[model samples]
Target: MTHDLLVIGGGINGCAIAREAALLGLSVLLVERDDLASHTSSASTKLIHGGLRYLEQYEFRLVREALGERERMLAIAPHLVHPLTFVLPHDHAVRPWWLVRAGLWLYDALGFDSSLPRSRSLRRDDTGYQTPLRQAYRGFVYSDAWVDDARLTVLNAVDAADHGAEILTRTGFELAEQAGDHWRVTLSDGRTLEARAIVVAAGGWTTQAMTAMGVPPRGKLRLVRGSHIVVPELFEGDHAYILQQPDRRIVFAIPYPGGTMLGTTDVAVEDPSDARISPEETQYLCDAANRYFRRQVSPAEVVSDWSGIRALYDDGAGSAAEVTRDYVLELHDKGAPVLGVFGGKITTARALAEDALGRLAPVLGFDAHPVSRARVLPGAMIADIETLARQVAERWPFLDPHDIDRMARAYGSRLIELLDGVDSVRDLGRALPGGMTEREARFLHETEFARAADDVLDRRTKLGLGMSEEERRAFADWWATAFPAG
Candidate 1:
């Protein structure tokens, strides 16, 4: 059947756009080549934050808009996104205290609801409670939110489905041709769809998607690969850290999936499909993690690592970090109208969706009514996280408090639904090593359109990060039984 809008890409931006449009009563079809959120969307630093580091680049407007979106996400999807505090330790080698204070102050002042505590200076003696490395530094605590980036994308897709959008994962748009002023799109799976307008929200493939439609690429998407390493828990609390290595580039050591998540080296790549972190990048990340933490991280200690490429808008910047994180849309009237997306971050995806629809309003001949601002994505909208935690505790009485805490933080009110009619942790089904469970796998597969083992264990969940080879293989074997490739 022909749809009003066909959105290519199941990343956050695509899912969000589809969700927003479908909720506005548009007939939308979202197609993804792989499992939903398996690309750059899931491979994020996992922060739903206004990038404080972007301040150095004078991206105040982007930072402010992102900060506003963070608050809205925290409110709308209280389950998937919530407030996270970051302790910016003042190193003598880095920027001075006053300069740091000014940045932090601006970070706090950039127009966001103050549900979280305001920025504060902490003494060195008091800062040791936050981290083990407590030498030659003061601390400044500020707010940013953490998110289950993959789940956020999936939930948006789910909501879109609830609003009548057809979501097709493992089905890719292979080609597009004009048919009487409309577009006839061929899917890689041998399916064809007709749509009056199309939005190419394909994260890293924006250029290629547009080029296939016989349109010359206007703005280039600079593919920058970022990698993360997971290690054993290195002291905890919800507080995360931003570390500036000796090379002046910053790395984040975040609290993720019950372990310390260390990350993110920026290396430019010509091909997004070929992007992955190299051995040198791994060593660089470990060295950066070792610099701040008292416990040194060796390569052997890296349990697992994952990489994702960021689609940055090329503004002729020499360095990946210097490239703008903002997004741009190019509309091609050639054949059918193709609105191509380039370069966006997770924090601003919702706004990006609205902006994209606004841009397409004139072309589609249908004004997209405003939506998604006051709306809550699926599995969010919990009245209170504390009350939801209590419900989860009652439902899984035998589960470890720490594991339950992780579930509650990640799933919010949906923890009860996920654990529905199940008593004790065993009812949640087979436990792979590192807290991996069969029930969680089934949930992702049944609800979120997860078709592969890695989609379940790696991106949809972080169990792969902590799983041993034996454990990963076991999960893979079980997953193959459940979902063999077609």
Candidate 2:
């Protein structure tokens, strides 16, 4: 069957664009080389916030657009995206207190209609707040939102499939050429498909995919590597810390489910696949965190480390940190139109998708209708997380409160669907180390496109952090037996 669009890549942008196009009554076929969000999309800092530092670079338009999308995501996916407060302690040696205050004020102004509280100043003796800072005279607390990045991408794909789009994971796009008005495409599995238009949202692999498809390179992309380390809890507050380094870069210490997530060094690399954290990068993150918190962290305390590559549109910036995070779409409409996506952040992915669809509408001979703005994602039927958790606990009183909460946070209103007819713990099947049951694993495989054990333990849910090495091995063995590879 000939489709209206052939979307390559399964990252946030690719999935989002596929959903948008399908909603606009276009047939879309999205093919991913690996599992959805297995690359840069899942390896994000997982915050939905206006890049505060971007204000320094005078990126007002990008910050404002991101702030608008942040509010929309909170409204749509409350369970996965919730408010997070950030405490930025003043460090006069790095950035002055006045400059930081001004930046915070500007950020608040951008999100004036935000449901979250505006930025507030805090004294050193603020109650219920403690930090290990040497000189914590004052600090500013502002609002942002945290997200389960991988789940967000997966839900978009699920929604797209529900709208009649075909999602083909582990299927690579091999080649393409203009055939009449449509593009004849070749897949890695030797299947052929045709589409009137194509979208390349391959994240870090954008340039490579474009070149391989014979589409002339539009511009240069700087592959910037950002790494993070998960260590023991650094502080005792629900709020996270954003530290300003001497080099004018910012590192965040977020309170993750199992521990503190410290990160993100900006280093330029030649290849996108070379996204592993180096020893120097780990030490650098530890030193950045130690500068703020009284309790010092070392590389030895790191439990796990991850890294991702960002394909920033190279605009001749001297430093990787200074490169623009804003995305640019290049359209080649010589025959069968191909839209190429460049640098973008997770917070603004939906907007990027909308813009991408709008640009490709005329070429594909369809009127683009904006539908995602009013529609909820696959599991985001409910708007309030607390209310959903309460209802789940009431229905399944036998289940542990912690388990119910985790399930609700992960699946949202779909938790009810997962627990349908399951009145007892045994009915949910054998319990795993992190409270995950065989029933949920089966659901993930069937509905969320989960194939491997890591797809369940790591991306779909972060239960792997709490499991022992032996537990992980046992779970993998059980999964292999329960659902063997074809």
Candidate 3:
């Protein structure tokens, strides 16, 4: 089949672009080498906000656009994206008090249209952030958002499929050669596709994908690994903290279910695939948290951890921490047109899709009208999520309230379909730890493209965190038996 557009990569940007183009009346095909959001997209700090720290970098335009998209996400996917308050503790040794206040002020002003509350002055004892060793100081409080980054990517892919786009996972785009006005593309599965225009939105492997298509690298990326450690819950509040390191780098300690998600060190690396946590990075994060909180953390205390490559655009900032988070889309028109993407934030992925299609529309002879923001993603049609959760709890009284709440966030308005005909626990089929059922696994496999166990446990939901080694093994055994190889 000759698709109008063939999108490479299945990260946030690629899925967003596929959804937008499919909505624009184009015959589209999106191919991902592995499960969607299995890599960098799933490993995010899971915040949906304008990079408040970017204000110091003077990236006003990028921050403004990200804030706009943050509001858009709240409108389109309210169930998946919710407000999160962050308290920034002032440190006289790290940065000037006036500078921190001024930066927070700019961060608030730049997100002018944000429905979230503006930044305000805060006291040392004002919130969950505290320490016995630290001296007296002040801070600021503001609101951003938290998101299921992996689900957001998958939801976009689901919406694209609804709009008639062919999505193939475990399908790699190996090579492409010119075939008159179109490109003859080869896949890892021995399939050939004809595409009028190609869009490369591969996250970390973007440069290499460009090389395969016989195009010179148009953008340089500074690969920075961001690592996070999950430790036992440190504070009681729902709020998070933004800690300032002496080296001018900022780390975030957000609230997780069973633990506080502490993170994110900016260290440079040569390859994007080398996304593994180091002992030093773990200690670095623990120290970053211990510096603020009375409860000290050790590497041995880390229950779980993750590392993802940033693959940021090289703006000649010398250090990887200073590199720009803004994305660059380069187009080449030698025979068939090709568009390449690099370094985009999760909040602004929908906007990035619009920019990508705008470049491809003129070349491919199609009218690209904008409709993604209006056409809301799947599982997000409802206006209120709390009411929906209440309804689900009432309908399925057999289910636990906690399970209902988690499913409400993960599946949104689609919970009815997911749990249809299940009036009791027996109907839910074989049960696993963390409230996972065989029926739920089947639904994920059939609808959400969750083929493997981790695809359901990790990306589909964070249920894996609560499962033990024996519990995980039991689920794996059932999964292998239930869905044998074709």
Candidate 4:
């Protein structure tokens, strides 16, 4: 059987493409070499914003489209995405206050159709905003969003599966040969399949896959490594801070579960698969944070760190930081067609997918149709998170409110289905560290394509951050006994 579309990669862009194609009634098969979101998709700074800084680059159209999608996602995936106010403290010496204000105005104007509040002045003395700052510089507060990046990717795959898309994680795309109307494709596992067309959405692996599939690079790929460091919580409030560096780059400090997530340095690298945070990057983040907050952190205080390669479409930018974040879709429609996805952000993946399918459908012999932007993701069937949390609490009064809230956010309406037969604590089975129950582990493994404990601890949830080494070991031991490796 020939699938209508073969989607390579399981990151945000790849999964979004599969979900969109399947929703259009096209048979789709998506192959990922690792677990879903094991790469760049999960290693994000975790924002759903219009890229206010892009105003400096004059990417108005890109920001406008991203902002529009940001609003749509707030409605469609309310469980995984939540609003957060970002405070951008300005130093008049570097950028004049008027310039900063003008950028904010433009940012708001671009997102005029969005439901989020407009940007406004934040006084330096504002207690909630200044308590952690060293000098209490005047600031501007604007609305944006924070999201569970990993879950966002996985949820897209879940919806794609619900729509009959075959999602094959741990399956790699080896090569493909054009065979008349369809292409015969081979997987890493030595299985051969057929597809009507191909979409190389492999993120950093795009160029490599295209070459194996006998397609040209079509464009240059600049592999910029973006790294993040998790440290002790920097401030008290739920609000995040966008700090401007002397080099004109911006770093964000957002609240994580037990710590704060500070990132991201732009450094060029040759290899995409071996992206790991460097000591210099860690020091850079620490120094960047130290320059703003009264509380200073060293590389020693860093609790966790991760790195992801941005496979950006090189437009001849001199530096990595100067590279554009906009995505470019290259369609090689010679005979049997193949589409290539370049750089894109989580905030723009849905829109990118919509655009890709609106273009690919027609080329693949199907009528081009617009995807339903209002369609909620699978977990968002019950949108009201608080209501769902209350229901879970009422059902499992023995569970802590915090744990219930976590489960509700992670699984949303599916939490109820996850515990369909549960009535008491005894039914929850063994309790792991960070409040992961035996039942939740089973749910992730049986339903969410969790092959290892890290997929549960690090990806499906942020539980690993709060878990002790001993606790992680215990969970791993139990997992090995329960689901022994095949």
Where's the lowest-lDDT run of ten residues in candidate 3?
Answer: 127-136
- Give me the overall lDDT of model 2: 0.89
Report the lDDT tens digits of candidate 4 across residue range 331-381: 988889999999989999999999999778777878757775989987787
| TM-score to true structure, per model | 0.92, 0.98, 0.97, 0.98
Instruction: Please list the residue runs of candidate 3 whose C-alpha ends up more than 4 Å from where it truly belongs after superposition.
Output: 124-136
What candidate 2 gets wrong by more than 4 Å, as runs, is none
- Residue-wise C-alpha lDDT for candidate 3, range 1-486, written one tens digit per residue: 899999999999999999999899899999998899988899899999999888878899999999989999998998899999988888889888899889878888888888999998876666344443254448788889999999999999999998999899888999999888899999999999899999998887888888888886777888899998899877777888888988888989998866999978888999888899999999999998888876788999899998989878788998888899999998988789989998998999999999999989889988877888666678987758889889988888889898888888889888888988887889988876667888888888888777788888888888888888887888778888888751
lDDT of 2 by residue, 107-198 (tens): 99998889989999977676545445656558788899999999999999999999999999889999998887789999999999898999
Question: Cα lDDT of all candidates, in order?
Answer: 0.82, 0.89, 0.87, 0.90
Deviation in Å, model 2, residue 284 alpha carbon:
0.5
What residue pairs are clashing in model 3? none
Q: Please report, as a residue range, the 10-residue window in candidate 4 with the lowest summed lDDT.
A: 363-372
Reference-based lDDT, residue 138, model 1: 75
Worst 10 residues of 2 by lDDT: 128-137
Model 1 lDDT tens row, 1-486: 889899999999999999988987889999999888888888889898888888988999999999999988988998788778777777768777788899888988995465778889866566444446645567687888898899899889989998899999989889998887789989998988899889998888888887887775788778899999877776567678888767668888887654688889898888888657788988998888777787778777876678899988888988887888888888877557888888989999999999988888877777776788988877675777777677666766677777777677666666777888886666778875568678877877887778887787776666676677887788788988877772
- Model 3, C-alpha of 317: deviation from truth (Å): 1.3
Clashing pairs in 2: 132-294
TM-score, candidate 2, is: 0.98
